[model samples]
Target: MASTLKAVGRNVLFGLLMAAAFPIALAAQPSHPSQKVTVLKVNNGQEVLVEINGEGRAVRLACIQAPLEQQQPWANQARTALSNALPQGSVVEMELRARDVYGRVVARLLKEKIDIASPLISRGHVFAYDGYLGRCDDLNYPRLERQAQRSKAGLWAVEGGVSRPWDLIEASGRQTQP
Candidate 1:
């Protein structure tokens, strides 16, 4: 019993040491570490799972709303278009913004010197999400969204128009509420 207790204490100490060392190690890494990632798969219109130097992480495009799957009219199309735009295996420079509730990194990606979100937005594959406007300081965001709305691009071409994902989610919540 004494030997077991000693072993357990050593294990706890080791765990604490590792836990404390982790942040120090992470902080030692370069600020704004060059995040070169390869798109492994499109999780949704607004998110992708990427591999950066063999580490995988979820990256949610900042300041954008892609249709939820059931939102239809263009949910799959949005994902497909985004996938085509950020072809699998293509390397991109990800500018980190913040992390979402789902623990996904929020970032704007650049591919071939072009903002990855631009074509997607201009083509109406996604909406300029205004919920977290403070983090979305992109000036072209609203203009591109408006252009898509006016030009009847992508889902905007659907009859009665496409619903924003956040709105759809809110509506769903209301419906489900007592």
Candidate 2:
């Protein structure tokens, strides 16, 4: 009985130590800080050059894939839509995610507290990027895409939506994720 009581006391002490250390460990870890950035240019439907912390950074919109330049009219339309949404000099909150191989910051952008990708996806200007949707609302994005298809909005106005940018990239022998 004494040995059991000693073991229980050790376990409780260990638990208290871990509980106290956890917050300290979390505080030491680097955090992704959201910053207000000014839009410098819209590179495409899903990418923008923005000025953040006084440096110009290229940021790709997370969780949505836009029509590629080679996709013609749809591509231009998507770009125009994005440009309208984030015109030069407009400020947006940028939530940084991962950086891509091309040195672009993959991020979610918000204006007026509304997620920019949500509107773009709902409008059918872009598709819900399936493979690279970590930390995004995967279910809602696809649902919005489906709704756009049903309503025949933007790219979905055609019999079938434009070919996915990834598909075209693959056909062109590029293995990079867009």
Candidate 3:
């Protein structure tokens, strides 16, 4: 009985030491942040799941939403650009700003592996999404959009150009706050 208790105590002490050395709180703490990620899937029209270090989860792009899967003139180019930016297993450092009820992390997408939010804006993919109007004005954005439209890139390639996600969501009788 005495020997058994001593062995158990030693095991307990070892366990405690290990835990103290590396607390459970420290688990999954990213060594760095990624603003971009692999397009795990275009979940629905507004949101997507991206992988950070092979672990997948949903991330809400900060400014504009790409065209939902069904919407014609959808930002197909945006999706393609994003896909190219973050290929599978590509390291995308994200700075998680917050979480929505949908269990998605809201963040500013990066450029050149930085948290610039330039990619979404420069491409004219989103209209400086009202939630972030102050950040980038719609003036030059339209120009960029025009450029894309001229090139028939992605959604622009569509004959009438891509209908904004807001228009589609509203047409569908869904929320259109953006």
lDDT scores of the candidates, listed in order: 0.81, 0.86, 0.58
Which prediction has the highest TM-score against the true structure? 2
Cand. 1 Cα-lDDT: 0.81
Instruction: Count clashes in each candidate, considering only residues at least 3 apart in sequence or on different chains.
Output: 0, 0, 10
Give the clash count for model 1.
0
Stretch of 10 with least lDDT, candidate 1 = 169-178
Ranking by TM-score: 2, 1, 3
lDDT of 2 at 10: 100
Model 1 over residues 1-178: C-alpha lDDT tens digits? 9999999999999999999999999877545434778989888788899996688898988888888878775778788888888888999999887777667888888898688888888898888875553577544788898898899998788877787777777867754200
Q: Write the per-residue lDDT of candidate 3 for residues 9-38, one digit (tens) a residue.
A: 999999999988786557634432445565
Worst 10 residues of 2 by lDDT: 130-139
Question: Residue 56 of model 2: what lDDT?
Answer: 93
Question: Model 1 residue 80 lDDT?
Answer: 86
TM-score of each: 0.74, 0.78, 0.52
Q: Candidate 2 on 62-122: residue-level lDDT in tens?
A: 8889998878898898899899999899999998877888888998888988888888888
Clashing residue pairs in candidate 1 are none
Give candidate 3's error at residue 7 in angstroms: 67
- lDDT measured at residue 154 in model 3 versus the true structure, 0 to 100: 54
